[model samples]
Target chain A: MVFLSFVNCMRVKGPDKFWKRRQILKLAAHFYGRKRNCYSIAIRSVQKALQHAAYGRKVKKLERINLWKERITAACEELNIPYPLLMENLARCDIALSKKTLADLAIWEPRTFKCLTQIAAAKNQSYPPTVKAALQPPPEGVITRGML
Target chain B: MNRPISTYKRVQQWAVFGRLWFLFDAKWQNPFDSAEKIAKYLAGKHKPIYHPLSDVGDHVVVINTKDIALPNKEWRYRMYYHHTGFAGGSSWTSAWELHNKDQTKVLWKAVYKACGGSLLRHNMMERLHLFPDDKIPQELMENISDHMKQLRPVPKALHEYTEEEIKNFPKVFEWPEDYVLN
Candidate 1:
């Protein structure tokens, strides 16, 4: 690690460039053609891929939320309750369940979801005529203003 | 994990992912509305474990599709379009015309449209079994363990009502003796 002049000393990069290019090349190993082996090309593709990987992490979360909402909505529809009504009523009832949990219950524990819908439906006074007709009597041990 | 606990977990996983056959009686139901619900089940959106890439959709046995009711004059005005991918190859078929040609086509088309243009649309459609009437095959009937509630109740026509029901109907006011019946 000796430089002949101040100019050469300034030109030297810290540590080694091999490891730097190796890091980028590792990520670009699966890339095609020159992108996999060429340092300049691999660095560009690696940076772009890393950016996409970062963005996809956030997108994955939102997509899961959307899917949970869809599943919950489907379950609500099957029970003759609108998604909003069920969510509002559940919140009002102090039943703080996340969309993920509700969706899980809807599929794996449908009977439990049905009971939740019944509680929600019972709490609300106004309902669509068709849903009203289809509504079952509220479960025992729970009373709402509508019942009173 | 212990062997017994691992076996129990495996069984739980199977139970959670198992597909069920749904029975939807489409008699007197609006096909468009019914299709929306049917599409949900067909796509397995009703399940917590549903993933767009996973093949977890349930089978739907839709009976009495021939008797589906269309709102307004949709049967006359709603047209299904087809194209042969050539010049002057496009054709339009009315809902009624399509239904007449095949009793299940109208509802099938409605469900197809309801499923949207996802890559999984055809896969979901394969799970739907549309019967023109209630005469479902024994194998399919045996698979159905749950029924989808109809969106609307079937209305009873005057002739369909019993004599006792008509006689017991409350009248707002009796027709005046002098009033002549139309």
Candidate 2:
């Protein structure tokens, strides 16, 4: 059956659909011995394999942010603090932590993240009684600050 | 301890690049223990060539922005701000926001704030680069070989992590866990 397709099939899936020619050659080299069939059915097969690898990278990128979010949420949850609270305190303190960096710490350096939570908690606790209201100050405050 | 600013032959050009070194003080304490020390260390002022008015500063690069340590309660209280020219435009951003929002700018602000804001300071800052984490683009690495005398080998773990490792770490989910649960 495979032999019949090779002989009779008019459909010659152009290499362009697979990838750039250079990439196709790389795939071909990895799959079959580098020199034997530089361009053939074997090369096409290798291109398919290469396409799969590319997909794996794409999938990983899509999920990277999600994983970081999970790590941060986990760290926050364990500390009895929600992610939003931790973020708010940091913002209130003018502590700049990139999401990428925070996500990284939340995973690989939990100790550091715990310290961050402690800091935020301390900041929150140190606040005067009208704390929750301060997060989003009244329109009056906004007017005074913005227009008045 | 003053030394003339050293120059290395330029091998490549880059719009951005950063370098970090793990260093210990004479007493063996982490020199990076305080932001002041870190500011001094990166400023190259410890060297004899350190001059206040001259552009003798090295184009220091810093990685691991997140791993940087702070003394006592500094992290909790440090507030960053932005000006909008209007009276109410003075909005405060935190160190965390600066670090997380666009960390490169945070490093820029930190360095500028440390160096005593001046026109010359901007020139010095143009050379300093910071990444949120330790990763640098491959193209930047190619240019660095031209100007640097000593180059640190990129860590092996960084190569393996490639945004893929984040997915593999063990995960456990449980309900009834907290204040806000959906």
Candidate 3:
């Protein structure tokens, strides 16, 4: 009697069964035809969609960062400067502005952006200018440069 | 004995070159000079820290390319060449024929050739946009900070007449009833 009572089986369906199906079907209403009405298909799609939704929220943050980087680069160009140079100079001068802040200045405040560019331009680089000379137009083919 | 000289020097060399967004109005401007400016910005040559290997450049939005000025009779003489690697499939089209088909192509080609296939040129080309008219995409519009001074003033339309002006104009020359201008 104890062993028989201990054994649980899904043979007998209860209110929980219909409740689970109803929840899935309701969520799947936006889906086409059978996925909404058919419990089996609805279960599969809703499962996948929930997984995608969870992953998408994480990716949205990275996408916004990339957009800010592009905006900042474009803004720097408006003042006739390069993005990397501005970043380096700002860091050298101990200005801890973020990409979002720089991008905002590029779009909303042109004069301020220009001022920042001038400050960066004034801070001269100590490296041999030849580092830039390496940036010549390459002949359109395989390059065999042994030196880094 | 000197205070961290090597670290400071290295930091200065690697510092970021701030990018700028420029607007180029191709309307009625000499195509050659416009192309030169486009290439310079595309290659990031306008900066002191510009390196061919590094993508340190500005974005350029070019508008009104339809009205680009071509000097002399280059419209008839200038040619765009293309070829297919086959038995016989080479073709050459005049500037006028090409521009009529797509107004932005002329300036686009000019910037491409000016870059001369440099390291940063292809990525820089991604930053260079060409539009036939002033209608820019909303996303690109946000970054535009300043415009290059126009080379020549946009001329007033010679033959255009407003609807109200046409209605009010006095019919100075009267023709016979049978005479149809058409």
Candidate 4:
């Protein structure tokens, strides 16, 4: 019995493992019923919450980028310039503005955004492929030169 | 016949091509459970592009609405209710009574309730179709490339063994000379 007790003690789980589980349970303390009190369910909740949290972080970034793109596109449409053309000319003119900043400018600083659009429009006119594509005759009874 | 599973590979094909149709059998199915299941397809709940407003859901054709099995004695106890604005206009009928009259009504009502009860519910309901029997229209059947798994497995019917098979069956030991096989 004495030897068995010693062996059991030697093979016992380390304090680190115990503390890690306890930490996860602490994080899951707000959970209800067995999910908070029981080790198995609490650990599962913590792991699932962690997985979703990681996914939410990526989703947050993507959603913000989409919002910015939508804003910029709408502003470009009001100025009669295509989004791709405006972005290309902005890069050409060394106007290194992030989408978030551009979106803010589009909303709050419309005059400045309009000036930028004018520059892009001028660049679009002088540009070869864009101008040619814009001026192309309807090839196969298509209604419009621009993509509908 | 073998049906292809709509895994990531198959869904990717839809991105290049288009959506596919699914068939659901409501034989021995519960109202609430089947409603929730069908609602997922009707509301586009299973798709990644699903939104409450976007019309991304696929067509779902349900067969055997007549054989739908309710949990417990709900066919007797459960009520289908209706009322008009006029006095003494309220009426009630049992689920079985309603099903006997219009077998598809019970399932339709269940599905209507399961849908998110928003303004978009009507749009979602439009994609759902119910048939009382297995005799589906040919055009609808032609597009059904896959089948949804049953909620609970249908139990196999039991039958007695045939006399010829029993006689030919292997036995552990020969019967005693005096003993007679029953």
lDDT (Cα atoms) of all candidates against the true structure: 0.87, 0.55, 0.76, 0.78
Leading candidate by DockQ: 1
- lDDT accuracy of residue A43 in candidate 1: 86
Q: Is candidate 2 or candidate 3 better by DockQ?
A: 3
After best superposition, candidate 2 residue A58: deviation in angstroms? Answer: 68
Per-residue accuracy of model 4 over A1-148 as CA lDDT, tens digit each: 2576676667756578778788888989998899998898898888999999999999999987876776687677666677888898778767899988888888677888887776665545445455475574323322323422
Worst 10 residues of 2 chain A by lDDT: A139-148
Give lDDT for model 4.
Answer: 0.78
Which portions of model 4 miss their true places by more than 4 Å? A1-148, B1-17, B159-182
lDDT, candidate 4, B1-182, per-residue tens: 98887798688766623555779999998878999988877765554333455566777899999999999999999998899979999999999999999989999999999987699888878888799999999999898988777888878543466778778879999889999878
Residues A1-148 of candidate 2: C-alpha lDDT, one tens digit per residue:
2576665667866667546655656646646464335666666677577789899999987676655565566567656677887888778768899767887786567688777776676566555235573573232211222221
Which candidate would rank higher by lDDT, 1 or 4? 1
Write down the TM-score of every candidate: 0.77, 0.32, 0.44, 0.47
Cα distance off (Å), candidate 2, residue B85: 1.6
DockQ for all candidate structures vs. native: 0.48, 0.01, 0.02, 0.01
For residues B1-182, write the lDDT of model 1, one tens digit per residue.
65555888889878767889999999999999999999989988876577888888999999998899999999999999999999999999999999999999999988999999989999899999999999999988889989888999988899998999999999998998999998
B31-114 per-residue lDDT for model 3 (tens digits): 877787778777766553444566777889999899898999989999998898886889999999999999999888888888
lDDT of 3 at B181: 89
TM-score quality measure for candidate 3: 0.44
Candidate 2 on B28-59: residue-level lDDT in tens? 11113333444553554533223345344454
Superposition error at A49 for model 1 (Å): 1.3
Scoring only chain A, what TM-score does candidate 1 earn? 0.77
